[model samples]
Target: MKKVSISLIVISQMLLGLTVSTTVSAAAKPITGVNCNGGFFVRTPDKHIHWIDEETEEHVQVYDKSDDIYAMAQCGTGVVTVFEKQIDGEQQYNAIYSPNCMNIGSEKGLSSHIYQGKEKINKIDAKDGKLEIRFVNNTYLRGETCASVSAGK
Candidate 1:
């Protein structure tokens, strides 16, 4: 009877291991791309404005004069998009929005804004005289950002 009980325990452990592996694999799937039509605005400490293109991965310099720095992302369809932003030594902002250019919704100091959209993950790290923003798409963007921004329904 003892041998039988030990065998059953081993089988249960194997099954548990299999379940955990499956869950991890599903969660670790790579995000291929985002289906958004909007871009993100980032203002560096040197007073330079950078417009990051989500689709083309191009960086455009804007010569506008603005005091506040903000980042926004919008979807392409009518699906809901989740936006999250994290700043060094600052409170994180996480919010849900429709298909439009939604802000990060933070009232912190004016330096830089890092934005991440739905099905996308953003990793931001700032060090001595350098800032890095990495936008990763874990899944496709669902809705349209312009539709929500437009006046029509």
Candidate 2:
């Protein structure tokens, strides 16, 4: 009787563990893209403009006017920004940037170049009061007319 009781308890514990693990995994879905109804602009640290459509997922980069790109990531609404940084004399860092927070990870394989393809932008609606900007492959900034501010008028 003791052996049978121990076995049943162990089995129950195993099943509970499996259920908890499955629930946690299912709760956290990987972010792969964004959807926006208005354009969001990204101005790199070196002053370059990247515009993305509201309803489409697009790649963004941190670059300078001299055409040197430091990092790249895909951005859109409802998606966290995954940034890959490869700057000289600095350790490479890759992570996800949320609207008001950043979660850094050491995952490898981050691209630093814009995908070679035709870029598209559709003015579905006039720019709303909010402007979304992803910077340095590390930060996501949102504000009204923030893109123009970063544009260095």
Q: For model 2, name the residue pairs that clash.
A: 36-54, 36-55
Error of 1 at 121 (Å): 20
Off by over 4 Å in 1: 28-153
Q: What is the per-residue lDDT of model 2 for residues 33-53, given as tens digits with 9 covering 90 to 100?
A: 233224444544434434455
TM-score for each of the candidates: 0.23, 0.26
Candidate 2 achieves a global lDDT of 0.35
User: Lowest lDDT 10-mer window, candidate 1?
Assistant: 144-153
Q: What is the C-alpha lDDT of each candidate?
A: 0.38, 0.35
Total clashes for model 2: 2
Worst 10 contiguous positions by lDDT, candidate 2:
117-126
